[model samples]
Target: MRGWWQDLTDLVLPAECAGCGTPRTVLCPRCRAALAGGVPRRVRPVPEPPGLPAVYAAAAYADEVRAAVLAHKERGLISLAAPLGAALAGAVRAGLRGTAAGPPGTAGAPGGHGGGPAGGGRAPVLLVPVPSARQAVRARGHDPTRRIALAAAAGLRRGGVAARVLAVLRQRRGVSDQSGLGSRQRRENLTGALTTAPHGAALLRAGPVVLVDDLMTTGTSLAEAARAVTSAVYAARVREEMEAYRTGRSRKEGNPVYRASEMRRAYGAGHVICAAVVAASPDSVVENQELTKNVHRCR
Candidate 1:
């Protein structure tokens, strides 16, 4: 009901820009440019979390960007998802340019999943949103990250990328509000707080997975989300191996032990996981300037 009302109002009512409150526009041209005009680049927190995947961000979380994110996430300006998602799509593309080919036999492999001639030379990229706390979602009446992820997937598709949103991650436990929390505190609060859904592993095999978020601050949430996803995928592989062994199909198919070893090696090499967000802290932008020296700017 609330969503419907908001949508109706957005269509009928005059509005101010979510980013800068310019009169009579959802997002004025200048604000839209500020949101997504610059090249997306790799960003890393100062004391980067141990398990955080390589993350790319479209813009720094400051000034207009900050205001827009807050308005969309906290104040329920749901119409803002389109622009935010477009920025996130650019970030995903940037991350993909830097990602190495997947290990052979995995979905990310050249001929596997959505890749190669069978897939029309386009590899599908899965956008797995970092889950929000249930209480927060309930209070806000919507899940901001997931909403943006859906929009991002649409934008990616329109841009000729085979992309789709996968809401596979879920909160397994409650967490304290992260407001005013230090980086260390944020990490501690989110550790072991997330898990993949029961069927998430199978769906994740669709293609290369990129965790998506609206914003990244301390990087704790993304790191934890990565840990949970990796754990689930590993567990699923083990289960498959065990089932194959029990059915005596291991020898007919391939050596289960060798296959498991190869999968473990791929996991250790870290080519399978990466992340992207609409924005990151200004400090990350400063740090990423040097990293972007050789990276081709996304047109």
Candidate 2:
């Protein structure tokens, strides 16, 4: 398999830190810390966007984290998933650590932030990925956001967090490529354009959900995902409450997405937000003028 080849090559390859490229190691110790560094802070994508659940970022959109994410996303270094997931897991734990700064109510919403019981033992956390357009996936040859979410879930599971990825989220309608758009245009492009797939919304009622995205810039993308997620959460809550009353059963075993204890109780954020952007375009990387000092010796 390709993954096996990559693993083998990793051993023989003269490597650089995926984060900072210190050389010789797939990842360096210091950069590893940087990737997982920082408390998960609540990031607001826009001023007028609806109330979004708390989001935890492992590292600021700077330095090493940016490089690692770019390597994984653009270059397709599939092997980097492990380290990225590990970093994401750490961020999630930090966000769960009391008082990270989010909307004031959610810490008070159904589950409260204090590691307390929602109603049953503890509310489960579901990691959801913001869907990418089919065309982009086709062009890139892989679903970047979905892939990262899977990696994060695996990391969380290994940590005994019992996390899972529910890929039921999808786009409601199509929008133009955001590449040429400014912040305002990007906002317009994504506005009201996302909707949950058939059972996606219903599943969230049972536990907490944290929507995951690879990167967050002006927050337009995240805001859209959050809106779609919230719609689903409320719908699921209403349906589950009604179903419980009608069926007189604790949970609908038929619907794994919405088992009583597993309904989405929290929504958070995770992104590989980066530094050193290009082209100054929507999501391009900029070249380092100073780094050229060593390379071409441009004066």
Candidate 3:
């Protein structure tokens, strides 16, 4: 029934592959394989931005993968979201597996905040999509990253890993276009531009977050997004500590929690298990370390 419907739909619509223009298919198998030919691996931008979470990418942004991304993002080929999302799901799984050896507070580790014991008490992985500018979304007529994140989350759930998309990040202000900006200029443009949505703190504390984006160039956006999330978590922890102190319910043994810096240090800002993007530039992968080692060491 499903195949017949697809055949009928293709016949009427005259569909073609988004990547290679193959007849009668939304995406051909060859292009789909190109999107994730190798296992996802850690990728880092040169002159890595401070506070940037470790990122995993399924494929380098080149050839067919690059064509597919551009088609979906710029050409309004919305049907490409599914295949792109499946590629993202592969990257997400790679991020999860990479963190399996991470300490507590990280996702996918035994007894970790996101991956708890085997008895169904695990915290669901939260997929936090980086926000695009309001103007950009309006111009494109869709939120591409958020849509892909949602599809990736659905794929993760189907694969037996609890996951959900959390659209909590928002732009606090506008900035100029990033098309012509260099790395440092891009960082300057995005600094302090993002913030969490109202009630984001409570939601953040419920599980470990993995930043999601469709692409990564200079890594400026991801770094800024991480800073915003960390700032929110820091503020929330401070508020909780202050309330506990005032109510005589403080958990400290002797020294009172008076110093803001101390509290910040104790809670350690925010924790992003890692990041995942559908594709990234080949030059962005760090050159100084082995591939597997880099994947494990980035926390």
Candidate 4:
């Protein structure tokens, strides 16, 4: 297979830094620092898309970080997934920490910044990829976002977060290349383009969901993916509530009443807990005096 050949080629070829072409290393120490040295922070795209999840990035997409991502994704430097995954894991942690910064009323939304039950028994966080189009994957010979997401999940589990990659979102239709599109145009192009897979609803309910991506520009893709996920969550909740109503009547003729917060807690508001990315655009860096200022802003 192509992947096997690529792996073999990496073993046989002379090593060089993917970002700067430095000899004798896949990524030089300087480049590694450029890629992940910065703290993860919340980022918002200009003209943010509807349903866009709160997102965090390990580094800004510039200089060596941008080059490294392009090398791994476009130039087939597959070995870089490890470091990129580590970067993404940092972003995931920032977003998970953001849960603790939830505004005043969202206390029971699950996975708070605490270490115990307020965090939903420390349930495993589901990292869902914003899928690449099938055509794009065929042209590129691999799914870049999903590859990095797998690595991120591994890194997260190692760090004791109980994480797993969930490739549940799928493109439901064709889309034009995003290269020439502006933010609003990108949003229009991606509207209703992604949907959850069969039985994905049940899987999504397993734990807190975190949208994962290699890079974010206008955030259209993450927004669409979030819409699809939350829609499924809403439908699943309705079904559960209906079933509960029927069962409650049969058992005690109205012995139990479910609070709205109970429902919101069940699905985390169908809003993704947040999104994690390897890198973000520089303009999105919210420079605040208080480090936690941007943390609760996403809600």
Give the top-scoring candidate (lDDT): 1
Q: How far off is residue 224 in model 1, in Å?
A: 0.6
Kindly report which residue stretches of model 3 are placed more than 4 angstroms away from their true locations once superposed: 1-14, 100-107, 111-119, 254-270, 286-299
After TM-score superposition, the amount by which residue 191's alpha carbon in candidate 2 deviates from its true location, in angstroms, is: 1.1
Arrange candidates by TM-score, descending.
1, 3, 4, 2
Say which prediction, candidate 1 or candidate 3, comes out ahead on TM-score.
1
Residues 72-152 of candidate 1: C-alpha lDDT, one tens digit per residue: 888888878889999998888777666655533333444444222224544467889999988888888889999999998
lDDT of 3 by residue, 209-236 (tens): 7899999888999999888887898778
- Candidate 4 structure, TM-score to reference: 0.83
In candidate 4, how many Å is residue 162 off? Answer: 0.5
Off by over 4 Å in 1: 1-3, 102-123, 251-262, 265-272, 285-299
| Model 3 TM-score, 2 decimals | 0.84
For each candidate in turn, the TM-score is 0.86, 0.67, 0.84, 0.83
Residues 1-299, candidate 4: write the lDDT tens digits.
25877776764663788878898787888788777766787888887777787888887777678889998888767788889999998888878776653332232134343322233354567899999889878878888899999999898767656678889998889998999999988988999999999989889876778899999888888899888998787777667767876776333443223444454444443447788898776656454422232222211
Q: Is candidate 2 or candidate 4 better by TM-score?
A: 4
